[model samples]
Target: MMAQGKAIAVRRERVDESVSGQRIDNYLLRICKGVPKSHVYRILRSGEVRVNGGRVGPTYRLAEGDEVRIPPVRLAEPVASGPTPAGKPLPVIYEDDALIVVDKPSGKAVHGGSGVSYGVIEQLRSQRPEARMLELAHRIDRETSGLLIIAKRRPALTALHDMMREGRVQKRYLTLVAGRWPNPLQHIKEPLFKYLTPEGERRVRVSSDGKASHSIVRLVRRWARFSLLEVELMTGRTHQIRVHLAHVGFPLCGDDKYGDFALNKALEAEGLKRMFLHAAQLGFVHPLSGERIALQSELPDELRVFLDHLDRTEPQKHG
Candidate 1:
């Protein structure tokens, strides 16, 4: 651990392979111990921190062999806490030297921040203290459940990120949406813009001046008032699937952010207390092994039971 107390003299660090490809902001957060995130950003904005003898933005990705100048900063002593309680191990879908895939449950954030005290990554780290490196390869919405990847090594993380950007990773989600879907197969290409609301809530919407996004929707099943769809994401954007479906007038069943609010309330009474989105499948080539990898996760019992209820109460439609 770095020293925690009065401000220390500036120091330089040589980026190693272990941390290569990580964002500079994230790197500072890790090594600065108890330094405030705001302080870190302040220094970056003021050019107090430099990389390779030049100032870089917070989003800059560090490469191996890069030299970093860390400015002097005071850090508060970490608060003493009681012995950490053992955390429940996440369900492992697959694991190797390079990466691990786990079945993430709905309602749990992938990592801690904002109002979340701790999240999946924190719990996993607590469970595997001996691991040298563990970082999220990708993220899913907190209300979305399914296969989530965590890279065990820095090289694998970089490779996985590249694969996602190049559209080599195939991600599929199962969702129950309001109203019947008309087409058996449809491609939705919408430009999405992300913005913050007046109250400071982050949101995304379909807009003309936004980045191009694509989703392939396949009707899996249908009921009188609800449709089950398998959506394959071609471009990963914030709230891409939810925003796209909702923009097409088929909001996800329990999506509070973009769905029908009144319908969601009734859904809670009907026992579908959470969003009906599940990351059902992921297919990609192994980042380091040169082998193909495919993983799947089953829908949670609540979603399944809700479907059964619909079958018993609502009229069936051809799927």
Candidate 2:
């Protein structure tokens, strides 16, 4: 039976030969790392799980060539405090009759509600009471700071949304991640998925069966044990860069969800606070002019200080 809004579904996957010696529950827990072990066992008991197209016991051994099917059920989670208004003012990057561009600060949401009293858009309205209508042209993570385009009118919002669906807009980010990259520039064509945990937190990872996510990464500079990276997203998914980078073994600095906590602490000690991801550039067509516009935001002060430390500790590569 499916939930009211859901289309009843069963996800089937084959057990890899390497996992031949594991317990069924262990195998399930390993593949779905963010889920609870008890939940995996519960599914086993519920008769919602099958192996080799047959029902299996909790302690059943997972053999090399078994097909596993899992029934679908929506996991419940409390909504995150949606975007809320901020007392701090915003820096406008670009503004026209159709839309207003902003270099949004971190710790703010693009949209309002869920649990938040006010988001960036709402706060913008509070400050600029003259504005008539507002809508988000695109969205970035709440923890991420930089280039956000807001439509000031409904028609403009429609036009921007249409362009985004057609993949006409481009975004670029600046970030710092663990370890040094062998290549100065490279592209990662990895697939990604967001695995929801029982605690209502989120984990991102690379998966064989996942949404296609592509990023072009460039090693801008390196410190004693870290690297500054420039990332241009070819396809967008939740936490795409953070997930792909972590899967490649170099999580972003200060990204608690998809980062190394120990390293984050060390960076924090150095006063390299906040997640290293920053939306640096945005390019899109004008809604009315039919002309293209590219906008950029300078690296924030914190990132600059971190860069300073890198320059002092590591050999600089001059272009």
Candidate 3:
């Protein structure tokens, strides 16, 4: 076992084929077990870390044969049983040789990072240790639940990424906003710019200098104070639906970020603990088979129950 606080030598490692194409920070995180993320980033920014004898940003992808300078990092004390397996098995919606589609529950992240210890991918790996490759095809917010896809092969992962980038993938979400939806179908073509808050939390806002974003929101139902809407993304952007709706005066229910905080607090007291957003449907061509595939998931029980509560308390003002 490696001793704690021992004077360690700066070592250089050659990137291997197994870790190729992964971000440098991620690669370091995997090998530098127990090192704090801030410390890792600190070394990178201070030029202690190098790729081919030059400083590279955290997002740099590692290629085979690239030499990386690794600084000595003190590992955290290990537990009795090398860190307990993270997360649990989730409900699988569909599975094949190339992919695995699961009904992800709300409050669970797709992958672990940024203070999250484990997520869907980690849990799935723990459950299927024999599987050679497993990676997320896309990501949804941790507060959002529903159909999520995981690629089982590298080629499938690459193809899925291409499909999403070319706008060939159709992602549909269900959300309950704070006001009555005005239109049956509305095309929201607002550009979104990502920004960080004073506390370093990620956020997005509509700005002319931002990336082009498009969302089609169709009214599904309406109550006196809330409206259920189906949101389709024509262009994928971070927090696209949440930002777009909030900008147009319809913040999502239970959304802590870019939402009415007062209303959210009241919602929590009323039994809604999570954001009212879910990835309800996805349509795309199978990357390997060239077959059109469409999948849908029903509203989670928590969301359905909340909607029922609204129906019982607030009379419908619009359809």
Candidate 4:
């Protein structure tokens, strides 16, 4: 147990297999009970926290057998705030010995951090503490609700990563955007660069010196002011769908980061509170078995309700 209000002496710990691949800052945050987030970053930036006698960035991934030096600081009083909370569990889409797929709802982060105490991964871990290994296979934005894959074993996780890199995994999303989609079938190839805003918020933009991204968008339907689209991602990049659509002049409805501000305000007045993006389907071969598998999740009730409202109020528009 962490001693509250007592200054801890500096200690060194060797990374083991269990902690390999986790970010250093996250590991510190978990162990340093009651320490403020700013302090963690401050220690990191000051080089007081060293890995193998050298300063490492916050995002540095830990490796097995790496020596981590932790400077002692006073621990905060034990607070119940950070413990995993009980709530409605995410709906399970598919489960096997190697993996588990769940339908993650919007507004829930995939993992805890950045002011979120607990998220889908943490909650799942809490719910199944007996399980030896469980990790995220991939991530969907917090506002995007749909099928999320969780690997139950390290081998399974590795297999999924290889599959994603090889483009064997197929993912599809449904979104409603601000303008009519011009093409029945459209392909967007853009380069995206990620950067932090002045306020420390992460953002992405199209840049010449950026990573290559590709998205295939098919028009699903059209309304008076918005068009529903089915987006198939060819290259997975940060904010690929949102950024691509915004660059193409069809920003996603209710997208706070890369959306139209005035239109978003109008949309809120019309009762659409969340981003209109859903990971509707995922297809990949089984990691353990060679069989092909496809999982799907229907639109959440709120999105469905908003779509119904649009259908009732806005007549279908012909391009």
Runs of candidate 2 with Cα error greater than 4 angstroms are 1-86, 113-115, 315-319
Candidate 4: TM-score? 0.79
Q: Judged by TM-score, which candidate is best? A: 1
Candidate 3 accuracy as TM-score: 0.80
6 Cα displacement, candidate 3 (Å):
11
Model 1 agreement with the true structure over 111-219: per-residue lDDT tens digits:
9987887899988888898987889999999999999999988999999999999899999999999999999999999999999999988899999989999999999
Order the candidates by lDDT, highest first.
Answer: 1, 4, 3, 2
Tens digit per residue, CA lDDT, model 4, 63-85: 88999999987776665667657
lDDT of 2 by residue, 52-123 (tens): 778888789877578989777444343456654447788999988878899998778886665665788778
For all predicted structures, in order, the TM-scores are 0.87, 0.69, 0.80, 0.79
What tens digits encode model 3's per-residue C-alpha lDDT throughout 1-319? 7546444578899976545677899878877877889988999888899999999999999887999999887775665667557555788888889899999999988898889978899888888889866889999999999999999876678789989999999999999999889999999999999999999999899999899999999999999899999999999899999999999999999998889999999988887889999999999988889888899999999999999998889898854
By lDDT, the better pick of 1 and 3 is 1
Better of 2 and 4 by TM-score: 4
For model 2, the local distance difference test gives 0.80
The order by descending TM-score is 1, 3, 4, 2
